[model samples]
Target: MELTNIGTVRDILGRHGFNFSKGLGQNFIINPDICPKIAENGNAKKGYGVLEIGTGIGVLTKELALRADRVAAVEIDTRLLPILDETLADFDNVKIYNEDVMKADLRGIIEKEFAGLRCAVCANLPYYITSPVIMLLLESRLPIDSITVMVQKEAAQRLCAAVGTRESGAITVGVNYYGTVKQLFGVSRGSFMPSPNVDSAVIRIDLNKKSELTEEQEKFFFRVVKAGFSQRRKTMANSIASLMGIGKSAVYSVLSELGLPEAARIEQLSMEQLMKFSVMLMEQTKE
Candidate 1:
C-alpha cells in the first residue's frame, strides 16, 4: 500500500482497472521526494487542516495526513476510490471524498471539518481546470491560510510572474490581487507514473494581504481588468472601450488622467495601475 512506489501504484491501478483520464489531468506522482516536498511546501504544520484536490490514489493525501491535523481530499474520479481506500487505510486523519472540489460546499466543509484549526489548500491541480479551480478557491475567501500547488512549468511561471510584465494574463492579475505567490521547487517530467510532456513546478501562495478596495469595487475592478486584456493586439483605449462599453475618447481621457498613454497595453500595466485606472473608469461610467 505504499502509494509513492511505482510498483505499488501500478499494482493498485492494475487491480482496479484505473485508466488515466487525460481530461482529468491524472498524472500520479511516483517520486518519493515529490509527494513529501509538496506536503511540506503546503506548510501543513500541526493543527492545520489541509484540503487537497485531485487526490490520485491518496498519495499526497497520505503525506498531508502525517503533517496536518485533518486532511480532506477530493477526487472527481471515483474509479480511484478503491485504490485510495487500500493505500490510505492506515491513515486515520485522512478523508477522501468522491466529489468534485469545484461543486462541493467548501465553506461548509471547512467549517464542519476544520473548526478551530487553520486551513490551507494543497493540490496537484488539473491543468485544464486550473483557472476555474483557483478562481473558486480565491473567491470563496474560506479562512484559508495558504495555497500550494503543482502546475505545468509554463503555468507556474505565468501565475508567479511579476506584474506589469507581458507574461501577466488576466489570471495572473486576479491571482496577484488575492495572494502573494512564490515558487517552491520543480518536479522533472520523469517524476510521474505516466510522465507529462512538460516539467511541473510547485508554488506556494500565501493569502496574507487583503486588497485595499471593498468587495464590490474589487468586482468592478476585475471587470476593468478583463476589459483591459480583452484584446491584446488593440490599444488600451480600444480594448477597454470595447469591453467596458465606453467611448474610446473617454478611455483616452481616463488614461491621460492616470498619466498613461492611450495606446498602453493592459498586460503592460501593473496590478496597482490597473486598480487605480479601473476605479476611476468605474466612477466615471457611473456619472
Candidate 2:
C-alpha cells in the first residue's frame, strides 16, 4: 500500500470510517520523502528497536518497521487503530498499542519489547503535547539511544536552540541537561494530508549515556531552571527567589559567588554556569 499517496490514504481511512480529531492534533504526513529520512536518522536499523509515539496511518511506522528489528507504537486515538491495521498488515514486526504515551509504561515497554536490541524513539508528535511528550521521554531515563520527532517549526527552533541564547527557554535548558538536540530537516505545512497552519521540522535528540548528577540533584536543578525562566523579564535571582520562596539575598549571594551579576537572567547563564549556580543554591538553602 502506498501510504503517502493522498488518494490511497483517503480511500483507506474512508473505508475504515476514520474522521480526523482536531483535539488529537491529527495531521498525517502525505510526503513520501519525510518518513524514510526520519526512520534512517532516528537510528532504526538492523539491531535497533523503535518505539513510535504516534503512528499516523502507519506511514512512519512502516518505515521504522522496514529498518528496525522490532517496532512498538502507542497511538492515543482508537479511531485510527483499524486504519493502522489495514496499512501495516504486511509488517509482522510492528505492534500497535492503543494507549496514551504520556501515561504508558515506557520502561516496561522497552524492557519487554526490545530485549537485546538497542532502542530508539521516533514520532510525528502532536503540536499541543510536543513539549510534555519530549520531557516525559527524557525524564523517564529509558534505555533509548535517541528521539527523533517532527514538531512545529517554532518549537523545533527552541528545542534545538543553544542554551543561554535568546531563543532558549526553560524546556531548552531541560533538554540540554539530558541530551544534545539538532534539527534534521524542515517540512513545509503543505506536506500533510489535511495540512497544518505552521511548518514543521524533524529534530533528533541523542540521550546522554551517563549523567553526572544524582537523582536528587537533577530534580533540584530543573526546579531552579524552571523558576529562573518563569518570568523572562525578571532577573534570574529575583525570579528564582519569588517562585521558590528563597530569600532574594540568598539567590543574589549564590550568583555573586559564581562571579555572576545580580541582574543575570536565565538566558544569560551557560549550562555549566547554571549547574554551578544550582549546586550553590542547594547549599545555601541547606545552611
Off by over 4 Å in 2: none
Instruction: Give me candidate 2's TM-score against the actual structure.
Output: 0.98
Question: Candidate 1, residues 220-276: lDDT per residue as tens digits?
Answer: 888877777768778888887777778887778788998999788888888888888
Q: How accurate is candidate 2 locally (lDDT)?
A: 0.91
Best by lDDT: 2
lDDT of model 1 at position 188: 94
Task: For model 1, give the 10-residue run with minimal summed lDDT.
Answer: 224-233
Which clashing pairs does model 1 show? none
Compute each candidate's TM-score over C-alphas. Answer: 0.97, 0.98
| lDDT against the true structure, each candidate | 0.86, 0.91
Residue pairs with backbone overlap in model 2: none
| lDDT (10s digit) by residue, model 2, range 30-106 | 99999999999999999999999999899999999999999999999888888887888899998888999999999
